[model samples]
Target: MNPAEPLPRAGYADVRIIAASPDIARRVADVLRRCFDSTEQRSYPAGHDGGTRLQLTVDTAHPAGPARSWLAASQPQRADRPQGSEA
Candidate 1:
């Protein structure tokens, strides 16, 4: 994914993982959290056989533009003042 490309500002992205064991599923979830800043939305048993299922949701937001533009837009500039005096 290109960093400069505009991303979807709304809706949730679902990520599902199936692992041989609960511990492995949890480990995968941990990696997803670190990579995408997401959290586990839910978890369950995979089926009659032994395994685990994990789901994670990533909430989308509009990208803030380049750093310099964001900073300029967010900060208010002070008015120029006379050299000698405080108002």
Candidate 2:
């Protein structure tokens, strides 16, 4: 949740870790276990036959921090100019 901290895990709603860094991976498993019933937490993987996995995955994701700063710089602010200095 914190920018300083990296996201090394994914897919907690489903029973699969998808990808893990092996550092906070055990924490990820704990989160998934809490999200689902304890029984389901014990079973199921990426895709299970006759089972449902929401298939929620991230692809082509970019960090928004730098993008937001870039966009902010492009906006026109009256403070940038003084008394209609230039066009």
Candidate 3:
């Protein structure tokens, strides 16, 4: 699913990301925070030697319009960073 799209205004949604490394996982979580009104529900080392795992929850019942707007505005700045730089 497109991360930029707004979530439904009902129930709850969960997102899980497994990054190549802990740093990438953290960066992804930060970017997700900018795009959604979500809470960092859990974070832990993945089993089977996988990278860090991050889980986030979005309560669609809550307002998220402002966060979406901010995400749109910040995309340009985020894109300008060097490919491997920290988020």
Query: Cα lDDT of all candidates, in order?
Result: 0.66, 0.40, 0.71
Error of 1 at 8 (Å): 10
Expressed as tens digits, the lDDT of each residue in 24-81 for candidate 1 is: 9888777656545465458898988898988777543322334336646777766785
**Alpha-carbon lDDT of model 2:** 0.40
TM-score between model 2 and native: 0.23
Q: What digit string (tens of lDDT, one per residue) describes model 3 on residues 20-78?
A: 68888888777667656687558888877777888888764453567656646766565
Which residue pairs clash within candidate 2? Answer: none
- The candidate, 2 or 3, that scores higher on TM-score is 3
Supply every candidate's count of residue pairs whose N, Cα or C atoms clash at under 3 angstroms.
0, 0, 0
Rank list by TM-score:
3, 1, 2
User: Over all chains combined, what TM-score does candidate 3 have?
Assistant: 0.52
Top candidate, metric lDDT: 3
- Number of the top TM-score candidate: 3
Every model's TM-score: 0.51, 0.23, 0.52
